[model samples]
Target: MNKIQQFWSDFCIVTHKEGIEYKDAFQFGTSADWLADLVVEGKKTATTSGYMFYEFENEAIPQTGEYYIVLNGLEEPVAVIQIQSVEVIPMNEVTEEFALAEGEGDYQFWWNAHEKFFTELLKEYDKEFSPNMLVVCERFKKVYSK
Candidate 1:
């Protein structure tokens, strides 16, 4: 498998999520050296959302709590997500057959799921903000925090 595929496969194994999905959603003009991959396990709380997996070259790793704006093909950011923490598992931690036989749809589903999760968080915390912008802004804040 190619580097991208191998990295993605390793990420999926670490995340323990199925239905590997990918999109070229990194910011345009971003270095091609580091490959960012996101994985969603089963549903998670707003705070947890799902698991996000990223792989970089030369052992470089993103700082914890860093956020990223994931864009779709239209160049529109569909979601703002953050890296809560970083962990390094042995390459052997990932098994073979990481590729899925079927493909999931776009990242929109991820956005929507995170939105719901964040909304629940707001409700629990009693925060104030327009529901519409809350999702975007919250995500943006998380992304820019890095």
Candidate 2:
């Protein structure tokens, strides 16, 4: 089996969960090494994404209770996580507690970094950034990691 399939097999055996398939598998950010490290260290438990990006890619909104495989920079599976919560709110409406859960520093840091990152991502698609734009905030639990 490939790495991810083997990882999934191992996870099933260890967790004794049946009839559950991962909803998605992906890296946290453009570069996942540092973020993956944070996750492995139990620092990052939440993430945010622009709603427009999801629309741009025609992807469904993340739902709670869904499992996912977290990948690193090398596109190798590193951890398994389950979505604890998902919310769609305006970017300006994000809470300090939620930002802190992201493990990226304080709210100011989260705002500055996310604004910059989303600004660039929107620009690439000829979309404009707005504070009122929708943001998908997802909180997940690191069930297993290496």
RMSD of each: 18.3, 1.0
Residue pairs with colliding backbones in model 2 are none
TM-score for each predicted model, relative to the true structure:
0.28, 0.96
lDDT (Cα, 0-100) at 55 in candidate 2? 94
Runs with alpha carbons beyond 4 Å of true place in candidate 2: none
Q: Over the stretch 24-135, how does candidate 1's per-residue lDDT look in tens digits?
A: 3354112112111222221211221111112212323444555444444444443434545443333222112211100122345434444565456456446432323311
Worst 10 residues of 2 by lDDT: 11-20
Candidate with maximal lDDT: 2
Query: To one decimal, what is the Cα RMSD in angstroms of model 2 from the true structure?
Result: 1.0
Per residue, candidate 2 scores C-alpha lDDT tens digits across 41-98 of 8999999999988899999999999999999999899899999999999999999999
